[model samples]
Target: MPLNFAHRGSLTEAPENTLPAFQKAIEHGAKAIELDVQLTKDNHLVVSHDHKFTRFNKNVTGLIKDYTWDEVRQIDVGSAFSEEFAGTNLPTLEDVLDICPHHLFLNIEIKNIPVIYDGIEQRLLDTLSHYNRTENVIVSSFDHVALKNVQNINPDIDLGMLFYYRMLNPWDYAANSGLAIRSLHPNQVYVNQTFVQESKRHGYEVYPFTVNDVNRYAELVDFGVDGVFSNEPGVFGS
Candidate 1:
């Protein structure tokens, strides 16, 4: 059966990338979880989807990189979603690592584009190492340069290439990129049976993003995808 990766930890239920959302995902039978990570001004590794807090915080409208971890944590990232999660704060990478079971798989997507964070790859590796959570974790990014930086720092860490556009031969692109990619995270609309088959043939897993529809999930399973990133975690578990 294909794995069900809770996108931003069952984001449909709680504020994305928060501790509560991750807990909800586990309760909803998600064996894997996908999250976005960014660097704060104080060099803290924060778990957030957007570079700016405007989406989550009404009082604050600035980039995450401009604020320290202290400032970032104070913002109520959950209230926008609902009152029940009013006090929910942005979680650090370490914070998320604390709650995750060793058996749970993690797909950590580095958000480094538009505002690059220097030495983020090394810091991420260090944190994972400190917590002994390197295993069963695949670090992915849309920034190929950041992925390459990760590879140069640690060859053992698995990397996933994330792209939205359709590629004629992604497997070839992966092979040519010179990075040992573990998976291909493409937009669900760009995925097909041939894409899945070819990716598997090249020894790379295919995990399409944000698939919430039940029929689409079944179709992807039929296409032989390794898994899917979904907000509705319960819908994909078979």
Candidate 2:
């Protein structure tokens, strides 16, 4: 079956990236949970979609990389969205990993292209090594170097390439990189059945981004792609 991933959890119904949102997505029957990651001040991996935490309490300041996890935990992330999510603190990658269900796959995007996570790849590998989900996780990023770094650390895990927009030949990029792309994500206009077929021909899967409007989703489904990243994974098929 073609997979459906919730972009930043079921962001349509809950605060993006919070535990509540993730849990909501899982309950909604999403097969995969997609989220973004940034480095904390103390080198811990933080599960946040943005480079900074502007949506949180105004007391929180500075780049996310500049603050320790302890400091980050104090900030409230859900309040900006509404009182319902007022106490939502940013979750660490480990925090998220612990809560994720065994049946669903994970899609983690390394934010900030070219920013090295230092030992983050090994950290991720070490964490997954203990879990029964070695084959179920997929790491993705627009940062070719970052994805390549993760691949260098653990080749057993699958990796995908993410593109907010498309190029004439994304397959060439993946092919030249010496990694098998389990998935390729491109902008709507950049995608066509030809690229989808061509990517599949090269042994890669295609899953585009932010596709709303039922007709467009239907068309994308017709094009032979494997999945989609949508703001409302729960409502898509309903």
Candidate 3:
């Protein structure tokens, strides 16, 4: 059976990237949780889908990079999702790590494409190292350079490359591109039997993202994906 990763911690149930969302994923019996990470002005790693909080909250608007950890912590990231989630503040990367179960895999996607976080790779690795949970995590990014940095610093860590558009023979590209990534996370719309076959042949796993429809998820599973990132992990297995 393919692993079911809750995208942004069951985004359909709770605020994306918030502690409550992650907790909800756990409740739904997700085998893995996929979340985005970005650096604050104080260099603290925070859990959020976008570089700015405006998407999550209208009242709290600003680039996460422009705020320090203290300022970022004060933003109500959950109220916009629902009033029940009011006063739900942003979660620090450490806070999320502290709650994740040992058996669950964590895909930490570095949000570096829009904003360059100079030393984020080192800090992320260091934090994971501190918790002694690097083995349970996969560091992924759209930023190939950031992924390379992760590999250079800690070759043992699993690295995944995330891309939205369709790429011809992506498995081959990842295997031979000298980046040495272990997995490919493509948009679910582009995934098909040929892609899965190529990925399996190349010894790279394929995990597509944001697949919420039950029929589509089943189609991808039938195509032989190693796993899928879904907003509704419960539909797959919970």
Candidate 4:
């Protein structure tokens, strides 16, 4: 069966990317979880989707890269999602790793697009090395250059390429890039049986993103995607 990953840990069930959401995803029976990460100004790895905080907090307007960990924690990220989750705070990558189930897989996406964080790959790798969990994680990014840096730094760490649009036979590109992409995370709109088969035939796993519809979920399975990044794991994974 395809691995069913909770996208940002069931964003519809709890605050996206928060610890509670990840926990809820576990409760929902997800064997894998995909989360976003970016370095804070102090170089601490923080879990958040956007560089800007305005989406989660109306009063706060700043980039996550511009704030320290202490400053980033001051905002209530969960209240925007629900009243019951009012005090929920953003989690660090270490925080999530500490709480994640040992049996589960983690897809830690590097949010290096638009705002490149120099030395982020090394810092991330160092942190993973400290925990000795590099084998259980897949580091992915939209920025292929940053991905290359990650590959150069640690050839053992698995890497995935995240892209939304067509790039002239993506599987071929990944196969020929010398980066040795273990997986390809493409937008759900462009996935089909041919794409999935071609990808696997070339030794790349196809994990399409943000699939929520039950019917579409069935289609993806029939199309033979290795896995899907889903907002509701219980709905699709079940």
Candidate 4 lDDT at 121 equals 94
| Per-residue lDDT of model 4, residues 1-238, tens digit only | 8887888887887899999999989888888999999999899999988888778888887789989999888779889998989978899999999989678889999999889999999999998898888887899999998889999999999998998887678988998888979999999988989999999899899899888888888899898888888897655356
Quick one: RMSD of model 1? Answer: 1.0
By lDDT rank, best first, the candidates go 1, 4, 3, 2
* Top lDDT prediction, candidate number: 1
Q: Candidate 3 — which residues are off by over 4 angstroms?
A: 236-238
Clash pairs, candidate 1, are none
List, residue by residue over 1-238, the lDDT tens digit for candidate 2: 6786888888877789888888888888888888888888787778887777775666667778888999888888898888988888888888887888887778888786545567666666676777766778888888877777778887777898887765768888888888767888887666888989998998898888877766787888899989888886643333
Candidate 4, overall lDDT? 0.88
Candidate 1: minimum summed lDDT over ten consecutive residues — where?
Answer: 229-238
**Clashes in predicted model 1:** 0
Which wins on TM-score, candidate 1 or candidate 4? Answer: 1
> How do the predictions measure up, each by TM-score?
0.97, 0.93, 0.97, 0.97
Model 4 alpha-carbon drift over 4 Å, by segment? none
Point out the worst 10-residue segment of candidate 4 by lDDT. 229-238
Look at candidate 3 and tell me the lDDT of residue 202. 89
- The positional error of residue 136 in candidate 3, measured at the CA in angstroms, is 1.6
| Tens-digit lDDT track of model 1 for 1-238 | 7877999997888999999999999887788999999999999999998998888886898799989999988899989999999989999999999999989999999998888999999999999999988889999999999999999999999999998889789899998999999999999997989999999999999999989998999899999998899987666444
